[model samples]
Target: MRQLYLNQAALSARATTVIRDADNQSRYLLVGKWGLRADVLTVYLIDGSLEAEVKQESLGLLPRFRLLYHRQPVGHVSKTFGVIREVLFVRGLNWVIMGNLNSGRFRIFHGRELIANIAPVSADGQTIALEVDQPDHEALVVCLAAILDRWAKHQQRGLNPLKNRGWAPGLSSEVTPFITQEKNLDRRY
Candidate 1:
């Protein structure tokens, strides 16, 4: 397994951040661009080549996003409207994310194979630990992790007024927003 660390504080505070390995070696550069409705996160290899990119497609309770690898749409990651657990569907890759995702701690699987594990985010919400099973998937995993971290932070901010209430075609909140059991959970892409 390969261990990696991301500075959550840097990622949230700046436009660009550096991702490091267990030995503190610079592995990739993460750059985020905030958009009116959608945000984009791009990852670049240490040598200055593009690794991957995740772009947001929609907002509200069930956020949607698409992932690009080699500048091609590889798949999409979207939140499911679940009341008990926060579930995300990775369409193209067929990846499953389980465990405490709202807290930034979870295991990722490609079908039946475990591919990566993200340690519970630090108490200060400033660091994230990632253990990936394969070296080739390192960049992709890191990029995905960043999106997860961003969403987690958004959840932490608590947009109750807009999130708690649902807007439907009629004059009623009959369409309730999907609620996760955990309060501190958030996500982005």
Candidate 2:
């Protein structure tokens, strides 16, 4: 297990486990932070299952991104760049949201590669929304929606199906719905 810290505050004490999918070479993990706070900090691992050769380092970091739920502040999520608008793990893809403030473009990255980009939809001191390209772009969004839904359920009930090793229904179900929806949407166009 590995320890994760945020600003010297212990975020997660146990090392998050990363599971690999043999079919597509994708990696998955579950990460959460426990503390005396009103909100829970959680992140679903969506990519990079590769073992850490070093002692302990974050897989990625994002310098200037904020997470919002329905216009309310959720928490901060990071990527390798600096700050990320969002991070989605679906099937075998890791979708990372990046913004180019100077160009007014919002870009999505799969691993280290650029996958898509769209114009900025909205932004303020606290949050930013980017218009994702539809149909094809729906895959990432749907995956994130599924993750968020499951995460909310887990937080409320104190149970996470993804924590199970052999019969992880949360991960399977969360991914399947998004894939099916995205496929259907793709077939439509």
Candidate 3:
């Protein structure tokens, strides 16, 4: 197994994250961008060649992403609503991701075979470690990690801290910040 490390809490618009190998040598670079309707994330090799690209195609309850390797469609990753655990359906590659993705603990499986294992490397949850079964799939794994992190962050943003034991159910977390700002304004008035 090839052990890789991703040193980013989340990928934001205009942020670049580096994926390093076990020896701390940079293996890939993930550059994130804000698209007109969604987010775009691209992966490049250490030498600066485009390895793969992931574009968020939709921003609904079940988000969908398109994956490209060498600018060719490899497949797409789409989240499926589940009450027990997070599940991602990877078309084209016929892979499935199952487990608690928000916690950064999940496994990617291709059919009955295991492809990779992802988990937080630090207690602070700042760094994530990936153990991939093959070296050639490293680039794909990098792209998947970025998308997974992005989706997890998106889920968190929709949560309402004041409801459902810290979950807002139908309300987006964006309102909380605005509500806090309004409270500050009230105090000043």
Candidate 2 wrongly placed segments (more than 4 Å) = 1-77, 80-92, 96-98, 111-116, 121-189
Cα lDDT of model 2 by residue, 17-99, tens digit: 33223243323343443222223323344653221111111222212233433334333333333423234322234455554
Task: State how far residue 2 of model 1 sits from its true place (Å).
Answer: 0.4
For each candidate, give its TM-score against the true structure. Answer: 0.76, 0.21, 0.78
Question: In candidate 3, which residue ranges exceed 4 Å CA deviation?
Answer: 10-14, 34-38, 82-85, 161-189
Q: How close is each model in CA RMSD to the real structure?
A: 13.3, 20.9, 8.2
Alpha-carbon shift of residue 84 in model 2 (angstroms): 12
Pick the lDDT winner: 3
lDDT at residue 170 of model 3 (Cα atoms): 53
Candidate 3 structure quality by residue, lDDT tens digits, 19-128: 88999999988887744446778889989999988888987666688889999999988766664447777899998888775687889999889999988889888888
**Candidate 3: C-alpha RMSD after superposition:** 8.2
TM-score of 3: 0.78
For candidate 3, list the clashing residue pairs, or say none: 160-168
Candidate-wise lDDT, in order: 0.77, 0.34, 0.80
Top candidate on TM-score is 3
